[model samples]
Target: MNFFHGQETLSVIEWILRSVVTFFFLLFAVKVMGSRAISQLRLLDFVMALMLGNIIAHPLSDHRIGLKGSVISTIVIIILYLFGIFLNLKWTWLRNTIETMPIPLIKEGDIIYKGLKKARISIDLLLAELRKEKIADVKKVALAMWESDGKISIFLDPQYEAITPSTYQLETELFDLPRTIIKEGKIDFQALKQINKEEGWLVNELKNHHQTELNRVLLATVDYKHNLNVFLY
Candidate 1:
């Protein structure tokens, strides 16, 4: 029993050591490869990562890299890499779709309430992220966008006179009535009235904005100059 326990303990220690080595190796490779592998995430980068993992996984394991496994793995990685390249070239939308859009954490001097809700993030969390970028004041942020690969972009407001409404119109894209206006436990009556600028406006507006239940909106505001801000629970 003592001998058996000793052998088991040794096995566990060996496993732990192997895991540590594998982790460090991968970490080193990632560091050498740079941030683009995660940020841009091109087909080449993805395939290289998979191949790198497989290459490292083999040496760590008890099994040797046979001629067949080596050739097959290489071919599979190559095929995947080629396919990704083809997709990127053939379909621009495919690449665009795969890449995440900049999420609006804040819009037009207001912390986009609905955006945070959609992202399942909290105000404090968003503030913490902004603080990392040396941004303490929410008012200072004109456009705080969450980037493609888990990056936050804080666009500070330019120190200039506000442009004319005509300039605003030129700069903005005219959109129809908002779909989901009231969000994140807040009211957007102004937004409701704006769209339903007629009789029974409140009821119709509420219906359009899907405010059948008043308690649903966590935050709601509208800046027709840009986009409707909403946050729902």
Candidate 2:
């Protein structure tokens, strides 16, 4: 019996199985890492991709190792990483330890030099970020935070925000959040009650708008201005 006779056939089968596993598991591993890895590309995300890629390569090139061992090791690492992420999300202490919170770079028109230094953000860089947010003066910024994902969130002083209908000291009623009273030709009586409107009142109002039947109304909402918007199917 030739020593290598049947071994070649076995090697071909092994290669096919390993190829399929490696190809699919790479995608699975990335998904397990989470979507933030794609959108944010935070430090942890980059490290995971690099590490998983390295682990997958060694087994592909070396036929001496069983394909299952390498894949299993990769899965173990992913599981551990995911557990750490879950802890960071659920536990406050672990969250702070694993990922830093948004640092307050500016407060009440004063630059927090201490915070800027801690975040390793220079004055020039901070100014550049401010400019991107279209803030011309730091004095106009009521608050500015350096977000963990490497972006800046700016809250303008009430006076600095753009003029609106009520910006010029004009008296305005309190804004009430709108609620749907009708949706898809069905009356939401529960929503009407939540808005302090009686079912009979809604029917009467709908009649005023020439909408006699709830089944004919496609959409309706009562907004902060006490205005009823109704649309027919």
User: Could you list the CA RMSD of all candidates, in the order they appear?
Assistant: 21.7, 9.0
Give the per-residue lDDT of model 1 (tens digit) for 194-223: 665433543354457655544665665545
Against the true structure, what is each candidate's TM-score? 0.45, 0.55
Candidate 2 worst ten-residue window by lDDT:
1-10
Backbone clash count for every predicted candidate, in the order shown? 15, 0
Tens-digit lDDT string for candidate 2 (1-233): 12112233346666666777778888887787777767885556666767777878866776655556677778888887788777777889976766668899999999999989988999999999989988889999999998777778899998888898766678877767788889988878888777777888888888886656788888988995557988888
- Scanning candidate 1 in windows of ten residues, the lowest lDDT window is 1-10
lDDT of 2 at 170: 85
On TM-score, the leading prediction is 2
* Colliding residue pairs in candidate 2: none
